[model samples]
Target chain A: MNRGFIYDTFNVVQQNKIMLVYQGEFNQDIAKSVLAMTERNLDFFGEDVSVKRKIFNVMVECLQNICKHAEHSDARLREAIFMIGMDKDTYFVTTGNHIANEHVVGLRSKLQEINQLDKEGLKKMYKGLVSNDKGLSEKGGAGLGLVDLARKSGEKLLYDFSAVDHCDTSFYSLLIKISKNKIIQ
Target chain B: MENLTIKATDDTPEVSFDTSGVMILSGRSLPEDAASFYNPLLQWLSDYGKSGVTNPVVFDMKLEYFNTASSKMLLDLFNELESVAKSGVDALVRWYYPEGDDDMQEAGEEYAELVEIRFEMLTY
Candidate 1:
């Protein structure tokens, strides 16, 4: 499917739309490029104030995750890929990154945990996790971010894990939707 | 000892820590590169630890939003400060969050739990 068609399908009411997608090394250079592209896409799509802020927040978290967690040791493949798009109903944020097979079980459990929590439950969990005096393990160090995104979206997080290669280099995708009504036009 | 000051911008936070009596880091910090931005700050805290300043070092952190990488950097910063506390320098770190910003408050609490220093949550 064409990317433009995908974007247009979502733009039922809004005259314009925001869309950004990139596939590259998950390093400082790519992070900056994604940031710039995000800003330009917002301007081109005529994003509202609140949407802008929300998008910025979401991007900061997602891109930073790519930089911090994506399995970049592979000399062969790019570490991460991501997309941010919008329409009248909601703004869509998605990120895809490489994860070793060893990490998948834990990642699945974490997302499932977030998916199972009610708004209040997630809020409390977020508070509890923050209040707990524990050092950052490679996994949970960035676990808070996933919880943060789920809580803010007020929706069940959408995700999928698929094998990218023979040796368990899986590709993980995360999607966040922001309601149009909530945004300040 | 001289005071260190840095103005806040859209991407960076203002940092001002007084070496005289109270050491403070006040302002929003959402920098581009957490490591590069915080390296010197970490060094400063380490240096303060070696200075033998017994007075309580007040660290005021009023951040709106910080990325995960920055969170790691923050952990490093707090770890250094915790070491200072262990060395018997009365270190008091204050995290100031705007009223109703639960995220910042929770973040402060997180640091408090992770570090041994005297950390307080202040709302403005």
Candidate 2:
């Protein structure tokens, strides 16, 4: 008997202690549902209020990044994948999406720039971006989602981009870790 | 114009704009379409501006969590209030954060830095 990709993915998620996995078209409605589910899961686990808030903040940015950046494939196909996993005292939030090849360079550079920054560096950059009148993106993002994710999680962003079979496209995956002990502020 | 009052929902905040020159926004604000939800609030601000609120407009913001989209809308709101203040009406913002939530506190501080309004931070 042979297991398919779905089976392998499931196995990997379970092995990684993923508490939730969502793969499909991501829109605002779906984001709301996912947040609600995470909220309930956090409550059930008796997580502290501040921990829950941190996770929720990071989750919003991750989901909205998918909604704002994911390449549109077939209207019905899965455009992205999101997962929340916990290992010991750390919780990991990961989002994977397809992007046009043309966007790969810019996205990679931006992530690299963010990864290189310390917390103070990121904070200064965030303030600069927010205050710069000319910095607003067409999507109204101001390119602050990733920065906020880093600032809130207080962790380096882990990301990867790989070429896909389809021409001019690649799959982009981003992982952020939040510690239970570092709750709030 | 009539005062505006919107009840809080899981994804939206409770908003109250009284004719007495008081506005309060409390609860979580993670609306699906933040623009749609905030546009009316902005419009109300415009109306309040024209109404010539002689009394100081006190805005109490006690939000636990808000998404990035809401963050942008908040800047817009503060900018509007700044304009209203410039027009000779006193506008003040009281930003409330949980005792230990540094992120929220920092966020409030950031907003204060971006706008010209009189912004004060309070811990709950």
Candidate 3:
């Protein structure tokens, strides 16, 4: 579909209060759109500078994760799916992507570990993981981006997995939210 | 005394370090090749330390997003700074994370715990 169509369609779905969503192929263009939408939403919703930067950072991390880990080898198909929205009290950012069931365990473990940690604990965990001399792993869960997102939001991650086609493939959706007041502060 | 500058890309940020009197690496750093990008920078810091500058060396990291390997490099970088601090030369490390980004702020604290330097969190 065309960019205007996609943007309008997303705009319609999010008309009630304040929201933005995009799907299909995440490239530099999509990244730019995401940035634009975020800035617009911040302006409409009265987001402070620091909060806008935090949201921007979170979106970049999520967009990069989708680009880096999508199961689709096709470059065109890889850069797809992104959404951002904000209502009176909260701003929500969500992205959907395809992945294999085998990778879910690793992703879950990482999220679980991050979810359990308080601010201090997360920092300690991040340090230990980074300092470990074992080196990098091929797949995800190096504890870098995930930790970064968790630290930025200071909110528990909301996520779900839906079976796609057969058991091997699944659609994963992740949501991040920040309170409007907190953004002002 | 060395000057290092690398442009930022979609996945990374610009880096600028000056070793004229103090050692400083300031800017967003999410390089594709974390090790390769940081190796030379770390080497310069090492050499400066070995040169016996005896002056306070400062490292300013204002990174947005860094992968696991990059995180490790940062740890190594700060550890080297800590070593220089112990060697009689004053070492002061400043970490800036947007005030609203608790994650980055906490990251500065984490590095503070692991390294011997006063880590300050700034909202930028």
lDDT of 3 by residue, A2-76 (tens): 679988866677683446667777654566567777778678857677677778777877876775677576554
Query: What would the TM-score be for candidate 3 when compared with the true structure?
Result: 0.77
DockQ of each: 0.27, 0.52, 0.43
Ranking by lDDT: 2, 1, 3
User: Mind giving the per-residue lDDT tens digits that candidate 1 earns over A83-137?
Assistant: 7766657888888887887999998999999999997899788756654556455
- Candidate 3 or 1, higher TM-score: 3
Q: True-contact fraction for model 2?
A: 0.42
Tens-digit lDDT track of model 1 for B1-124: 5667777765567777778646555554545465677788888888888887887777777776676546777888888988888988777787887666555676688678777888888888
Docking class of 2: medium
Query: Candidate 3 regions off by >4 Å?
Result: A1-12, A15-19, A27-33, A40-46, A74-79, A135-141, A183-185, B6-14, B61-70, B86-88, B96-105, B118-124
**lDDT score, candidate 1, position A115:** 97
Candidate 2 per-residue lDDT over residues A119-149, each given as its tens digit: 8899899877766655335664547899889
- Range of the 10 consecutive residues with the lowest summed lDDT in candidate 1 chain B: B23-32
Query: What's the distance in Å from true for residue B71, model 1?
Result: 3.8
lDDT (CA) per prediction: 0.72, 0.86, 0.70
Each model's backbone clash number: 0, 2, 13
